[model samples]
Target: MTLLAENYENDPIDVLVGDWMSEGNMTVRAGTKISGQVDAYEPTFLEALQPALPHIAKYRIKVAVNAGAADTKKLHEAVTKMVKGQGLNLSVAWISGDEVLPQLLEAQKRGESPFENICTGESLDDWDFEPIYAQAYLGGLGIAKAFEKGADIVVCGRVSDASPVIGAAYWWHNWQRSDLDELANAFVAGHLSECSSYSAGGNYTGFKDLEPLGWENIGYPIVEISHSGEVVVTKNKGSGGQISVNTLTSQFLYEIQGPWYFNSDVTAILDNISFEHLSTDRVALRGVKGALPPPTTKVGITAKPIYQAEMHWFMTGLDIPAKARMIETQIRMLLAPHLSAFSHLSFQIIGSVPDNPTNQNAATVDFRVIAQARRAEDLAPAKFVRPCIDPIMCAYPGATPHLDLRQAFPKDIFEYYVTLMPQSDIQHRVHLSSGESIEIAPPAESKVYSKHQPTQHTTGNVVDVGSFGATVPAPLGTIVHGRSGDKGSDCNVGFWVRHQDEYAWLQNLLSTSFVQSYLLGDEYRGGRVERFEFPGLKAVHFLLKDHLDRGVSCTSSVDFLGKNCAEFLRCRVVDVPLRFLARGRI
Candidate 1:
């Protein structure tokens, strides 16, 4: 491709990741377009990938067929029989929609077309697409639009798992369109191998119960990188997942949904990467860390900008979930005596979950109810669910109403959770104008992410908040995901520090309103934080943002979901002063 990028030049890019699990939008290819958040049957090229798998020559990879369905021609004849006997170079890398849909239907029967025809969209039928698999998200803009079309190893199905090492660090080095800390150390070594079975140990909820965990052989993490974005992890041979250093420090706290999951231009500090199990599945990651935004990619962020409105109701039963939870707590006590009627009505109790012990009590319970309103008929839980099913045929005798309440489906749910904050935090444009900035080789790692300390997950940088939860105690392989499982209510628990000027004053006095108004009370007047990302500029992250308004949310997501969100945000910084719990809304 440009004669193998003018023969080698910067090296390092034999990447070949392929993760697939499909069912929907599989129309092979032709100028492909499934806009508005894309996903029209995608996955291409399997091997023969040669600027060199030419361990040297053997070529011949073609694959045809277009009009997809049936796992898009079996992920295109299993990647053309996995590039027949691997000797590939299919005229060097990228090409798949079953080998570019018979050369775009022989260039539209020889009209020598310009382009624009491929179609394939459908499957997101609003939430639960009933999908067993559906992949979309491909970022680094679809691997920089397949290396601007001269391709180089990029099969797909679901990307944005920190996109193929931020598309091999923005295509063969010299990378940097404004280095948000080297694209956040390549998006923190691709969010630790984007769910390839949680860095080789299989979604480890800290081994909640894993017995020699084979689970149909779970293995997948492999990120041997280093254009100085230094990552190591590793895996492939005899796969089955199980790398250690505490299973890669609990795979750096899976998903970590809070403190901030919003992305783009880096902030994933996941407790600053710096692992080292060296032997057993080989975990190294030697510093993926981040932070240093505000040189101006733009970030004023200190959040809480909501408008609120959320609703849901889906009931069915014979016992119809205790008569759909007494018609959802008497429709929030009959819309709380009509507060100027309908400004707010909140209630939630979606049932049938005991992890389905045959639906735990003979299966079949859908009394899902979620209501919130600043007015929308105060979130009509369907007018108190059809006058409580004729008093649920006089229920409560042995609780009846299981299903068939005249084939129920009665639906209505309006949404809103918007919270805004965009005044600036990341911005770097160097699109290469003013004559390639007089020799722009200055960024491949810019002397290893311009040193702000990235040792993978730890080598001690301390930011401790004591009584745990904001810890960075280092050496214990110091890796925490969301980078410390995204500090919402805090979790990388402690690394004892005295300065970076006490990080925004220990993050707004550990989320103030004068220290959570003595631990969440007095109409709990404080709570609102924008996504706090981290690839680890040596840690400092937080997220206990829940902006509870109207009424009730005081607490009980299992006494702190994940068995103790950093000990209830470190027992509000070691107790004493948090006496306010007279009524609720923490």
Candidate 2:
């Protein structure tokens, strides 16, 4: 709200859009709805909008947000009440029909759609958990229709993360559904802007460069889209944070699956996408091609909640590995009687206690024991806590518990299932402030492209790294920067170089086999590793399928969303050309 208020006051703002839905968030919200402790919708949006209501109405600024979560109607009512209480005449509208649980269940019983998991290719019938909530990813047409109806604010549920920006641009340009090229441009802009400060340098690798400017208040992004399908991305004039090609490049690669970025309205062929440095804190996006969207859109289903609990033990100083193994053995033996109750159990030793450490903290490693079950009773303190605490008396010297009673207790965990649903099956609609409901029809033209199409590339040229002279072993981050994110159980890590000369070496050195053997290592498991290249950006991207163990909601990994995968790869020791290192490390 602070950033929004400041930006609105200083910049020529068109519409404000916020994304509050993710795969994990959908699962969490489903659990929240079932618990009835609070409304299923995100209440923070209402709280944040209360103070900004006056300014919004005064400037006649339009607002769009997916803060509606699982209950768009309830959020709409809350926002309307707030607007009326503040004596504001802002017309509010909401887009719905994203929920498809009933339809999916009915279709499955009738043998219409198998609803196979996109990542694992397993049919919904094979899923052991019972689905309680399901939502289809909707397009921007419904939001655009709401805007066309003179709505001052629009609420949405389960629309694509970039749909708000697409809708805003569509309304502003009066674009037709067939304007795939223009819509694709807007889609790219929305994707960049959807994460707000991320594109403006929030999670950038080069933080030292942004330090002098102050990170206290990193500015949010503002995207200006021209009618001719041109985009200029910039941040607020006086806000902290830098917006350069590197920052935008990092975000562009974040959370994407391959070069064919899919959406309901159109598919963005990103093989040729490139960025141009316009000036300080400004960049122009180019070469984003458009194509007909797929016949189906992604749908997320939340099934029976899994109960989980954990206890952490700290091992310090010498013989850390031996001590950890002894502790694990004891805990397992203690819990043997109740082991059958848990669906999963693991004892992971995180980090290595370095030899001859300078500080005590550096010499200590965490031994974490995590357990998950279908019932809370299976993870009760008596079953989980007693086993862990029982080993304390006879444990190795300096064996200590990182005590947290709350984390040891059982908590609800939502299991997320991702699949595709035909767009024709969706009843996309928009409810206007004037009591009129508009039904949004599916795209007139659609393509039935194979989901397993051969990997696409912008260019076929490959340079041998051995050709680069006088190679010295160094961290990849010395010459390359990267960004990573997750999509269901799959994780994507994209690495790019600052100079064109280093691009070929990066492409050749970081092959699929190299990534699986070196970077992923034990985390690779038995998943498929796929690689793609963005030649225009001088970047190489990899998608590790089933990498994040049943997605973020149920993942046992410490890096829950796989956000650290890129950084981990960047830290790996690699042979680099001395000529490139002469330019100074990133």
Error of 1 at 22 (Å): 16
Against the hidden reference, what TM-scores do the models get? 0.26, 0.98
Candidate 1 residues 1-586, lDDT tens each?
2222223333322554433321112211211332223323443333223233443232311111122222333443454344455745432222212122233334435655423101111111222111121112323533444444444333443333465566666565646546555666666666666655766666443343345666567666666666656666766655565776545544554434422222334444444455666786787765444543321110111111112233334443345556556666654554444435433334544444344344444444434333223334443435533433434444343434334443223222221111111212111111111112111111222111221222222213334344323432222111221222322232232211122343322333333343345533442435442233232332333333443221111122223223333433333433211111111112
lDDT of each: 0.37, 0.88
**Top candidate, metric TM-score:** 2
Q: Relative to the unseen true structure, what is the C-alpha lDDT of residue 340 in candidate 2, on a scale of 0 to 100?
A: 98
RMSD, candidate 2, Å: 1.5
Q: Which candidate gets the maximum lDDT versus the true structure?
A: 2
